[model samples]
Target: MSFKNLPLLGTAEIIGALNLSPKQTASAANLAHRVAQSAWRRQPPHKRGLSYEEFASTVSDCAWLTMFEFGALLALGRHHEALLLADASRMVHHSARTDPPK
Candidate 1:
């Protein structure tokens, strides 16, 4: 598929297109979360994971949810809450990386 077609799609749809199983989907999500978290924890911080840009470009439904939640918190001026969400997202990422599904 092409980048232009991503926004119109969802994760399940993508997985379906790729013929991936539920376990595979979960595993991939976990793997991606870990990678994103590691980048976020870097000294200078990294622009990785399912960021708004990446979601928009790649049409990742999960990333879209995260970006929406983060943006909503920021819009409400809940900086602390947003940070917590970010930290949580990072933790999930780490979990996925360290304890991948079988």
Candidate 2:
């Protein structure tokens, strides 16, 4: 799925929460996107065994989890953790495609 379809909150709410400048909100979305990708990977180690429907449902749940993490980190001003989550998200997102989500 496109990252744009990761099920984010309304833009106004997100920007309000972060208290960012309009310019900063753009970068904030990128940071929150890291959280979204992390949430996408929050599946069981036995994911290779799941059916397609199971995978889709799991993706939906993980997407929400990523949103949760993004909100917390943003509220706390945890930019560094956002970076780490972004890096981890990239790695996990890549590895899932590679090794089938172990």
Candidate 3:
């Protein structure tokens, strides 16, 4: 899937939360696209054992959840962590591929 298709890719709300300028937002979108593309190619170590369909689904789901986590962190004034979560691949690689938080 294209990173453009990633959940909440370039919403105004996210832009505001991050206090991104127009140029910064564009740069961020490009960075997200690059990160997603790289993750698709490498399948992160934990995800390597999965079949193609599973891997795709896992990444998609994680992307969505990470957006929510990003928002929450921002709301909690956790700007630093939110910025890190902005890099979708970091969570995709470290978080679960299938399991949701309990």
Best by lDDT: 3
**What does candidate 2's lDDT look like per residue over 1-102, in tens digits?**
123534455555545665656456555555555554454466567655665445545555454445545644655678688668657866876877789534
What would the TM-scores of all predictions be?
0.43, 0.39, 0.45
Winning candidate number (TM-score): 3
- By summed lDDT, which 10 consecutive residues of candidate 2 come out lowest? 1-10
Candidate 1, pairs of clashing residues: 33-93, 34-93
* Shift of residue 83 alpha carbon in model 3, Å: 7.1
Off by over 4 Å in 2: 1-58, 100-102
lDDT of 3 by residue, 1-102 (tens): 133444664455666666766565555555555554566678667757866445545655456445544655555567888788676556656676666889
In the range 1-102, model 1's lDDT, one tens digit per residue, is 122322235544555554655555454454445444444455243444555445345534566445444544554456798689889987987898899579
Q: How large is the C-alpha RMSD of every model relative to the true structure?
A: 12.4, 9.4, 7.2
Which consecutive 10 residues in model 1 have the weakest lDDT in total? Answer: 1-10
lDDT winner between 1 and 3, please give it.
Answer: 3
Task: Output the TM-score of candidate 3.
Answer: 0.45
lDDT of 3: 0.57
Look at candidate 3 and tell me the lDDT of residue 79: 81
